[model samples]
Target: MASYQMLVKDVIKRADILLEVIDARFPDETRNNEVERDVARSKKPLIIVLNKCDLVSKEKLEETKSRLSKIAPTVFVSGKNRFGTTMLRHKILETAGIKGREILVGSLGYPNTGKSSVINGVAGKHKTGTSPISGYTKVLQLVNAGSRIMFIDTPGVIPFGENDEYIQGLLSVKDATSLKDPIGVAMKIIEKLCAENKTALESFYHITIGGQDSYDALILIGKQCNFLKKKGEVDDTRAAVRIINDWQKGLLVI
Candidate 1:
């Protein structure tokens, strides 16, 4: 992670404006506070970009934007669908307040937070490679974003000591098959869903989670999906992996 920190520092120093890309579903969880502090110390204009807005509701997006806008200029963008990319471009130029010269923009975010997709979205094409898998961007890339805007896309900066399995699972940094404790992560996901948007969870899995805890909910989903082992017991691991996969793929929102 030291190398990643160094890359972020280099980008902050070399670029004029910085974009902190975060998952719109879990803004606070995906944001790197330490990197934001570094950007603050540098006195560079930081834009808080809430990516994957398509997966979230408009009401929730407006609420999150209102809260995050107090810290910096915030923009809701769907990197996958290229939604609000024009607004993002305008925000970049408006924040930079520069003309007749190229503006170097630095992009930072956690793994799988759609940094590359945002770059490509703003560029109006596939300027950088992107994947759902984490750590896909291994090197710093400089792409011309047209209209005198240049972007410095760096690898996702996962803060040091951020090894929590649940957080990693939610961020898509570790996929369903990659997690060591898939069941535990899936339970956490269920708990969050139950608290935040139980209806969506029920609709997605076609299961009623009345008065059931996270584990029971997992078992219920397992039975609903017919993932059973011998003796008609629900396959906890398989069910957990399915939940994680769906959550990572944006099929299960909030």
Candidate 2:
């Protein structure tokens, strides 16, 4: 983690402008406040990119853009759908101007926030290695964003905060595939959805949670999704993992 922090610091120091990629679903959770501070201190223009906009509603996207614009130049994009990345590219090109040289543009974000996807989306042909697992791109790589722009892809930056395992799992910093208590962590995701918007969760999963708690709702979803174990038993762990996967992959609507 220390080495990753140092690398991020180096990237910030070297780049002319920084594009901080944040998750549209949970912008605050995915943002690296420390890196933003460093960017501010360095006096470089920072662009806050709300990635995975396809996972969110149009109204929600507007709300987030409006709210985040006050902090920095904000753009909402989805690498998965290849939407709004052109705007990101134009922003980078415009910011760097028509200089006859390479402009360093670095992307930094937490795991599963589509940083690599966004980079690859904008690069068009020069794609980077993107994966569902966290910390997949371990080293920094420079890919050309056309002829004038040099886009730098760095390792996912997970700042030190929120020690709660539940929050970590919720943000996808925790490895759900190897979690010791998948059901427990999965409950956190179900409970969060229920608390935030029970209707969306129930509607997406096609389950009813009327008068029932998160666990009950989860049980219904497990059966509905056919996550069954031996002897007709509900595979709570598998269901939990699927829920996490759904949320991470932006299948679950807010």
Candidate 3:
């Protein structure tokens, strides 16, 4: 995958259009400076594709789509499942008004945001390498999508340098997953769930956590949620593991 900086310059030099692929579940994390700068500088008509809509709630998804609608037409798609991918292509064609013109569509997003998966779906094959791991695509590769459309796949956006707003939006938009400080992330998730989904929390923890202190709740959650050590002590890793697992599986989608 090619770096956004390089792609920005190259798009200014060559491409006529830009399609930013953002994961709908984590739109704030995926839409960063690279996209903004590229679109702003190139003055190209931009199409924002909200990928991974399957992972997020419909209310949240519509809200995000409305938000992006202020700037560019937004299409919600699930790149992995091929949801809305065809509609997205049609939107691209309609926006560009060049059904037969050679068009360059820049596929971009942060790590694990499914840029390659979108390309593969658009191309009708697994031509681009996609994996569960983040940052799998290291170079910008161009894929042919029939006569008039070409998809340019770029590397995951680096949170560093010239794109902090996009990075911040992505990190804040999604549920707090990449907090790195797992304990803090877990605590936040637990507290949020305690206030929002008490029954699910109780089922997962087997204890009423609605009004418990955060620390006590954490321990109780650890015990019931399998975050316990062999000695039956509260283990931070196990606690964090459970919380992350729950968040990834949409059980903690508050």
| lDDT agreement with native, every candidate | 0.87, 0.77, 0.66
lDDT string for model 2 (1-254, tens) is: 57667777778876888899987877767777788898899888889999888877787788889998898989999988889988998888776564878787878877667787898888886443332322333556777767566777776665545455655676677778866677787787787677666788988988878877766777788999998988898887778888877876657776
Query: What TM-score would every model get versus the actual structure?
Result: 0.90, 0.80, 0.73
Query: Residue by residue across 153-178, what tens digits does model 1's lDDT show?
Result: 77666652545778889888889998
lDDT score, candidate 2: 0.77
Consecutive 10-residue window with the lowest summed lDDT within model 1: 128-137
lDDT score, candidate 3, position 233: 88
The local lDDT score (0 to 100) that residue 95 gets in candidate 3 is 85
RMSD of each: 3.9, 4.7, 6.0
Better of 1 and 2 by lDDT: 1
Give me candidate 3's TM-score against the actual structure.
0.73
